[model samples]
Target chain A: MPLLKTENVTHFFGGLKAVSDFNLRIEPGELVGLIGPNGAGKTTVFNLVTGAYRATEGRIIFDDQDIVGLPPHQINKMGISRTFQTIRLWNEMTVLDNIKVAQHGHIQYDLKDIFLQLPRYRNQEQAIEAQAMKMLKLFNLADHAQQPARNLPYGQQRRVEIVRALAANPKLLLLDEPAAGMNPQEIEELMVFIQRIRSELGVTIWLIEHQMRLVMNICERITVLDFGETIAEGGPDDIQRNTKVIEAYLGVEDEEIS
Target chain B: MAGRSGNLFSSIFRPVGRIVSPVWTALRRQLAQTPVLAFQLGVLVAVLLEQWQGEAFADLLGFRRIPRFFGIVDIFEPFSDLDFSGILAPFFPSPNNISASPLQDSVQALGELATTFVKAFFYQGPRAPGFFDVTFRVLIYDIVVFVVPILIIAFLLRPLVSELLRRFPKWSLILVHLIILAAIVLLWGDDGGTRELVLIFMGINIILTVSLNLVNGYMGEFSVGHAAFMAVGAYVSSVMTMWAFVDDRVFGAPALDPSWGLPVGFAIALFAGGIAAAIAALLVAFPSFRTRGDYLAIVTLAVNFIVQSAINNMEGIGGARGLNGVPLWSDLSWVLLTTILSVFIIHSLVNSTFGKGIIAIREDEIASELMGVNTKRIKLVTFLVSSFFAGVAGGLFAHVLAYINPGNFGILKSTEVLVMVYLGGMGSISGSIIAAIIFTLLLEALRPLAILKWVVIPLILIVLMLFRPQGLFGFREIELNWGWQKAKEKPEVSGATAED
Candidate 1:
């Protein structure tokens, strides 16, 4: 069975249909890329899947459970976590605490334990700290752990956001424009980082990006969206060659040469 | 049946084993780090034991009563005993006996007035060298009666209660409540008039400071209408108490006699007042939270005005005339009990995951919600709880003063609370507590200055703001380290550029 399946998901923001008849099925550990133009509802799809917005019509099944209408936090706790298109790090919090805060869902100690700082609270905190540090180290952001997130440079801040999402221990990771403001060198590094998270952590990856080069180079499969509808879905080479996908990214001709 | 019974026994023993070993380990670690705390604990335990054993320890030590300091009475006794008439006779012409003119009589009267003023403000009285001996004695006596108990109780009981908290935390709160109740009884039963009143006010201010800090500091919401909640509590509780206990002279027929049902009735009134304020908070908070920062502040300020005006117009509760004849059911004990309870609840809430959510909302609501923190519910709950405690403080205020008025809960009152919260440093419970005590004491001390008190207070605040804008404690919390609770260790992030 697929780890996540969304069938016929539709969403309307007032009268405007942001996403229509969207469908997705992802097996465990698959790296899927969602590429689209600016208003193609790529981020909206991630929002719908993560329960940030309830679809006007459809079902979202995750880990064999219907997750529709669940709150974003609950959806996240149920093993789907996402990063924002813009960096949304808890800016005032230390880099380490940003990661620790995301691990709130998995923390099992009762209020009594936490308030009193019981052995359980200590043990759990230690575990969470160790895990967060490991993730930070993995992302090469370990040196900036004590610094406030707002103090970090833009590229590192993006890395910290990804590490924070990973700290939630999600089964599926959603990256919205992870390569948005990065230089080519940083973008290349991010590609390797995404691949390593998939291979090493065994987490399924669903990324939304406008960087066509990065998407085509790294994604195993690509889904192209335009005008709130999926125009094409195939291997990167097939998606690149498809006329419809090409027309969505470029422009449509007045007369098509058959 | 035998197997089931064995399993039950093991289940109980398993937890007990886990609890005892860790507690023992923590205790050992605590003792190693802070041996003074252990010593203080020992002294407190000994005092408790002595009390339980019917003062055998005190009797053996030849102590008949707990030592006391030289009070106002002791300082004034010599002055009162002095024949002031004889001393002032040479300074003033005799008006009555010598049958002087109107001018001489007026001059004699003026001289008397000057002497009285001088005596009252500057001089307590002429004192012998023996007075110095008594002063030293009183200072030593004060250490035993006041200072030692506080030190022992604060240091020793905190850990013990916290340890008990790990097992039965709710019950531990009751233990704290009972201790505060006992302290109240002990202090109120003393005949130190103005000092006791000041202490009671301190308790009320602590409640205001801690509760307001919940919304303003922790939740990062600006609520300038805290006094409105207090007014709601004061009016509701005062009305309830007056209706139930006061005779026909005040308002309506008494539903409950003051002698028998006053405590129960007063308690119900206070709880009702808290609930009423909480309900009011719910109405304001639901809509106000939609707006952020200054807009939210303006909404709260408007609510404050509304509450004040509403109270002002209500004729039955005395309207602009203000309500009176509220039974003095609130004592130092009640104030102390409520203060302790409020602090415990707030402290526990802040330490919980729920508290983390509130703090997260304060930091960044959008980010907190995206992280799955249910920010709306957290914000609502925090507002309600904070307002509820403010109402409780209001109820205490009503009974303590034995009067209620819309003027008592004005914008100025809210500002007073804000000052305390800021002065103590936001997001710091102990800081709020210290700030409250100091604020209350400072206000009381400046009483003689009259209108100038306001000028001096603002000047002090201005200086405080200029130097320490974050307030005294800033973002730092005073978590009593019991060794088991490890301090948050920040890993030094290497100062490398992201390009590297």
Candidate 2:
């Protein structure tokens, strides 16, 4: 069984259909990519999966349980975490705190321990800090851990966002646009980092990237979305050669396409 | 027309401002640099003046009594028999009382002191009339009180007081508690009513400000009707005490002995008041789950109106005439203890993971929720706790004033609390405490201003908002010498950069 399976998921914003019959299957330990044009509703699909937007229709099964109408937090607890298209770091909070907050769902201590500031609370907090520091160290961002996330360089902020998602211990990690504002050198580093995340952290990766270099280089399989519909699903080579995906990105061959 | 007036104002005062500006800047810098010293000097002056010539001043201010340097006792009997016709005569006790009254043993005098303390202080104790019969020894003790502290603080302890806040926050908190204790001791004399009242009010204000800070500052919710909760607390606790504990015209007879009300009955009443306020807060908390920001603020305002009107319409209590004949249990010590406990509770809460979740919600509710924070529950709990403390403050306030009415907890009161929160800085506990203290004193200081007080206060707030919009601290805390923060600073790990 797939780690995540969305069977005919549909969402509507008022009368407009944002995502229509969006079926997706992400198997265990697979690096999948969701590719689409600007208005293709790629993010809407991610929102549906993460329960930010509940499906207007159909079932979203994660780990064999249907999580269609659950709140975002509950879905996050079920081990599905995603980064935003634009950065959404708690900007005033320290970088370490941003990562620690993401692990809020799986924290071992209960509300009682937290309020009373029991030894367990402090211990758990220390353990979390140590763990977050470890993740930061792994990403070479340990020196900036005490700094507010917004103070970090853009490339580092994007990386910190990814580290924050990873801190949640997700089985399936969604990257909206990890390579959004990077030069070629940074993009090259990000590509290697993505590979390392898969090989070392062993998270099932699913990403939506406008940068074709990141998409074609790392993603084992690519799914294309166009105008709220899946136009193509294939490996990177097949996707590169697919005329439909090209026309969606580069615009229509004919005026009749409209 | 507005632009012309503005130009005329600047044109008239610009040169005047230039001369005054330098002096004002220097004074501000000095005050800012040595706040502790200034505060100490201010307290010393007030204590000394109240001891020395407090009665004359109190009479002018229309106060029945002025608190003495020693709170309970009016005068020591040491040198009452010695009449000084020359130097130190005014400072020493007059010999006129020596022929009228026989000198008693010092131990017997102390016995009288203990008895009077218990009788007068343990809730509704008889307060003595005003008179100062100063003694030579009393003069020496007063000098020691002034000089020892100045010498210690200015030389040996000034740096320590400032340094203690950062190095030992809990110790600093204890130091503050000790200051309150010392203040109580210094103002323990028979005629020291005005200053003690001011001190108690400051304590109550601190509670009110800190509690509101939880919701308005830390939680980032604009709750304009906080005083409504306080009203509920005030009324409920007042009703509880007046009905069951005290014999009053309204309640007629005590349900239990008046003595029981002092300890057990009064505490339960205060707790009940807090609980009742928390329940009342549901009107806002439930709405808060659905609405936020200005919408939630409107709901709070409505709740405030609802509570005030509800109290106003209740003929059974006292309606708008107000509930009087309340047992005055909130003395300096009581207020001090409760304020510390309230501050400690809030400090612990904000430092918790749950609190971080609350702050995260403040930062970005959507992101916080998506990050697995139960934003709804957090919002609910934050409202309840915030309102609960407001209610507790109301209980204390009602007891202190020995009266309560809907008018006391009106929009004006809520605005007072908001001014405090903003002046201190949002999300700053220390800021609230400092602001509350300053505001309470400012209110008392401006009493002579009458109607001008309200105008001046708003002007101060407007200036504060203009100059420091984020407030003095702005989501940060003062490194106070006090607090019960057990957690030390984050550990420094020396290591190389992460491997590529």
Strongest candidate by TM-score: 2
TM-score of each: 0.68, 0.79
- lDDT by residue (B1-500, candidate 1, tens digit) is 12345888878777777778788788556545442334444444444543454234334433343322213223322233222343345446566665336456556766765565456444444442233433454455445544566456656655665565456544454465466455544443434476678778899999999999999998888999999999999999888878877884557788777775456777888989998999999999888887689987999999999999998999988998888888877777777777877898888778555476777788877767668676777788899989999999999999989867899999999999999999999888988999998898787665545555687799999999998999988767764543233335755456544543
**Per-residue lDDT tens digits of candidate 2, residues B1-500?**
12235878877788788888889898556445543533564455545655677566545544355424332223321112222132223334456633222233334455554554343323221333212322333344445445444444444444555565456556555666467556634464223477678778888889999999998888888889889999999999999999998889998998888888877888899899999999988866774668678988888889889899988899889999999898888876677777888898888878766677878888888888887887887888888888888989999999999977889999999998998988999999999999998888777665534555677788998998998999888888875322234354564546846546
Every candidate's DockQ is 0.25, 0.35
Error of 1 at B31 (Å): 16
| Tens digit of per-residue lDDT, candidate 1, span A49-148 | 8888888998989999999898888888889988999998877777888888788777777656754668887788788888888888777788888888
| C-alpha lDDT (0 to 100) for residue B310 of candidate 2 | 88
Candidate 2 residue-wise lDDT at B239: 94
